[model samples]
Target: MTTLARLDQFARERKRAWAEGTRRAAKIARERLRSACERAGQRLWRTLSRARHERARDLSKRVQHGQRIVKVGREHGMNVAAATVNLTRKAWRRVRGLRRPFVRAGRRVERLGEQYGALREEWAVERDIESLVDGGEPILFGPWTSEVGYEALYWVAFVRWVKMTYRLRTDRLAVMSRGGVSAWYADITPRYLDIFDRVTPEAFAARTAERLVSAGTAKQMDLSAFDAELVESARRELGVERLRVMHPSLMYRLFRQFWLGHRPLGFLQSHTSFARLTMPAREVRIPDLPAEYVAVKFSGAQSLPPTPDHQRMVRRIVGAVAERYPVVLLDTGMAVDEHGDFGIVRTPRIQSVREYLRPSDNLGVQTGVIAGARGFIGTCGSVAWLAPMLGVDTQAVMTDARFLHAHLHAARWVYRTLDAGRFSPLDLGGFARFGLDVAGASELLADRPS
Candidate 1:
């Protein structure tokens, strides 16, 4: 255990300790690598299994949808086949001279004629017209054509006649309308016809039948056989001895062809008088509305196509307005197919008016909602035409220029025609004037009539 022997033993011990440390480090590294590989394999398997499950579910849904479609198609085909068989049988009967029974049955099934006769008797008993008239002629005014807006316009001629001639007794006047006029039409007519007593189509038809029976002409009369005959009967029953029966189509033609052109003076005077007489106030309601809300109606009979650009523009306008006031989207639920296309997306500030109001609501309720709104925004449709009549401040975004001047003079409202092809600049000047600012003046422009 001299100095040289001690040094050699210590060096050997140090080298042995280093070799043992290296072996332990290698074992630890191998265990760590094995665990990492196992975890990676588990994650890969899970991802593959999840993807497979989703694919299977999607396939099953597609198969079920296909089956439903096929079933519907089969039912529809069966219905068509049944209809074809019935039609074929009728055609065969007609060819084989065996259609007499069907023809006789059809003749006996004149519900309108029978109903008309019954209605006339009921009216005669209820009204006591013979006593009420007291030798004065009772005048019946209508059998008004169905289009509500034009029906309102047609009344102008009668109003003009009353103003000019002063012969027809307003007190003895009764205005007739066909059944099933919309609540809107019913609500609106009072403004113009409140002066005259009203009669329904049933009563008018009944009266006509009574007259025909009295004249000994009702035996085999079919009122629906000829339009001219119907018109003549209406005139005779209504006691329209000399006054001409004017149809809405005739009025429209006259307005387009003559009244708006060379014969403008009389037309202008009459329409101006009509406007003065017919304007009435409307009140609307919004349930749980915020302090400020803007009502918007975009889809209608003349709605522009819901292209991507149009959708973007709508969103931009709605988004811009929503920042200042809650926006209520008013829709009639007519455009179910275009809902996804025209639906406002990404704006939390807009709500559907349909959520609060139903389609079945009366026209008064509908008009009140539009009239009560702080501001109205819509396309050039019935609602747009109505907004101004209700005295609501309105802004109309129009696609067609033809309607720009059609009823512009009827009421006051801001109208803007947009080019559907391009991204027309958002002009917020109108909204700004109304105290609504979505991106300042860059959002909308207040368009003026030319």
Candidate 2:
């Protein structure tokens, strides 16, 4: 019997024996941590913002410098993501490999078998152990947590750790065990191995905003908006002619489907302060979403406000861009539900071409779904964030002025407009021009001393 299996059996027997206050003990621990984080965050914020009226440039320069250095390092193959993946994989393998005589629920001792028969067929016992150690065991956290707040914190740390260290996002493994959707194997990266040790709630929030918000003006920008300099910079470096793109869609279905195989633990603890603290952290990653994505007006009796002509206008603009580019996807995720209804139906223009896909199909399968798109277009949604992380040139068009300042980083372009009530199609030529700008900036920056 493997040592781990033996230990697991022992532990399970112990749990069954005590079976009384185990859950209560865990709850108490969670509540304490939540309160601690909240109080700490408030204290930190008061201290950090006490400075004199400093120009935003000071902060931008420092942040941008750090981001750029990280990017450059990745280009040279210094991967924090790979390391994290390896570390977690290693830890997990050990946990899964020890053979043990499992005490069955019916009271008989049976040889505990591999969780996955397929894996057993392919790998010898030792080889399987190696895989687990290298890849770490995925701990599916959903069937929503009993403690939603703590779940949120865990997710925040997990996502940030991966992004910061590996420059890659976590690939969620979905499961269908608990209720509707849940995570099966949520991998932790090295970047986040000791996150709780280094982060307080305030720092976590700041870093989150820094990661999720796009770079530009202090206020949020609409999806169509762009920072001329940022685009020009990317264009100059990558060569304008070579960069191609399609309209942007958030690929909501792809992500939802990816999580389908996972579990969602119900709220595990009850702490209002903890909930409040993690909400902002989650919000930072969510980005300043558009009203249409946020709206869920249905057809016929379910309809409301006619989708504000502006939303349709936005679609038309996206359609125009898609026609000119290799691929264009509209992020209609705000209206998405488990049933696949996105409230607003696609316009004839968008439906006819047949390139539109749910986000899950495009991103999770690990094949050539989005591999070919040269550029990405959208509001500051996950797809936009992900495209740049994957190294695609993206122009995140934000209709809301507030989004421009929202801390979205790594995209090749950013565009916004002042007209809030109206939806104006971002000029395809404008985005093309922006790409040129980005390329140019890249060249200039490249020549500078490292």
Candidate 3:
């Protein structure tokens, strides 16, 4: 109300307005300069196409080399890998039509008093759970429309946390997921709703491809139309008018900060429980293999990408394992996701159980085989995470681990914390050093890439 206070407020307003006007002017000037440079650069690039192409090729080779370095070590390049998080994101923005995919989520959290943006996300997660708790209807815990590895590693563990945090009984729960992974949820619930029961495999696969194209990432963050249909189908099957759903998006949002390095591992530790995965009952009829065959399910995607050299490495490793024990390849025999199987090696003592696998029970059959196996060897990002919890010694293979560094870091700690099976990762360059004390170790080392 005083004249001096009013004068001070007016001066502050004038200074803020001047600062805004200066920022706008600077932005316009920079935009004009960038436009002029782009026009000039286009002409120059066309004239020196060969040089530009060579420069791009050099950068590509460097990226490939760095990918190999990440592949060989068990998260050896974590510091460098984490450093590239922002750089890689900017690179993605630079790519044609990638600005949308790389854009930050539309979450408005500035008012939530976030210490590293935790409060808002944690609040959102709790709100979702609160809805499920408030609803007296039967709660559906999935239609787990994501990778099996994520289902086993993160989704199931998150559900366990919810159950423990709320003290909910299994009788009120039902899980919806693909393949007959009912056994994975046996501890949590007896009711397992199969997505395959509602949608055909061909239709499910096509819809999933469309969903990925829309979301711009493999993790299912949004509820797609197909996802809604699956939920509706489950309701119809159960003869329920309404169903309370706990979707995978909650799990994705909760721990995403830790993955992005905005939050520490303790944040995830406080939110989710990382208990070891219990073996699913092997009631499904699996292939009659040797009493103690090694289960192998390597795919040429994500971690162990498909390349001629990588395929050769897979053959050599599988051949070495076969020399000691019979090998059972856990190929799904169909395109389940973006991952492509490493194909069957024609080497002696190797058998693929792909034929016996049905869409309805493919995951169940695989679980049964893996739980019964003496050990497991596969791609680092897939069952490697699950196999450790399955109580089977796992030799996870990967030619490049650029995208799996954080996941690998978490897996190491979880396995150690749970006192589960020994998880050993074999990198692209470490093939020569793998299983050196075991039978046929010399052959594996001798044939490794020099």
Best by TM-score: 3
The whole-model lDDT of each prediction reads 0.45, 0.30, 0.73
Q: By summed lDDT, which 10 consecutive residues of candidate 2 come out lowest?
A: 270-279
TM-score of 1: 0.41
Better of 1 and 3 by lDDT: 3
Q: Write the per-residue lDDT of candidate 1 for residues 1-450, one digit (tens) a residue.
A: 998889999988977996797578668757765775576557556655655665566556656755665577577775777656765665465454433434544454453345445434433422332233334554443444233334433343333444334444454554444322233333223312211123333443455455455645322222222224445555565556732433333333334423233343445344323322212224334556555567676652234446654555566666767766677676544321212225664346777655544323323345556555666776554455555544456666644434334454433211122111111212323443476644333144222110
Task: Give per-residue CA lDDT, model 2, range 1-450, as digits (tens).
Answer: 999999999999887865556466557757865775566566545433432123244455545755666677678777788755755665465444321212121122111122123223322322322332233223221122111111222333333332333233343221111111111112332211112223333443353344235543221122222222222333343343322111011111112212232212221111001111101112111222221111111121111122344345344444444343322233323222111222334543332112332322222211122223344444333333333333334443433333222122111122121111111222223333455333332232222211
As a whole number from 0 to 100, the lDDT of residue 408 in candidate 2 is 25
lDDT of 3: 0.73
CA lDDT of 204 in candidate 1?
A: 39
TM-score of each: 0.41, 0.27, 0.70
What order do you get sorting by lDDT, best first?
3, 1, 2
Error (Å) of candidate 2 at residue 323 is 4.9
- The alpha-carbon deviation from the true structure for residue 50 of candidate 3, after best TM-score superposition, in angstroms, is 50
- Write the residue-wise lDDT of candidate 3 on 364-450 in tens digits: 888888887788888887676887787888877776777777777778888889898888776764553463332253254223311
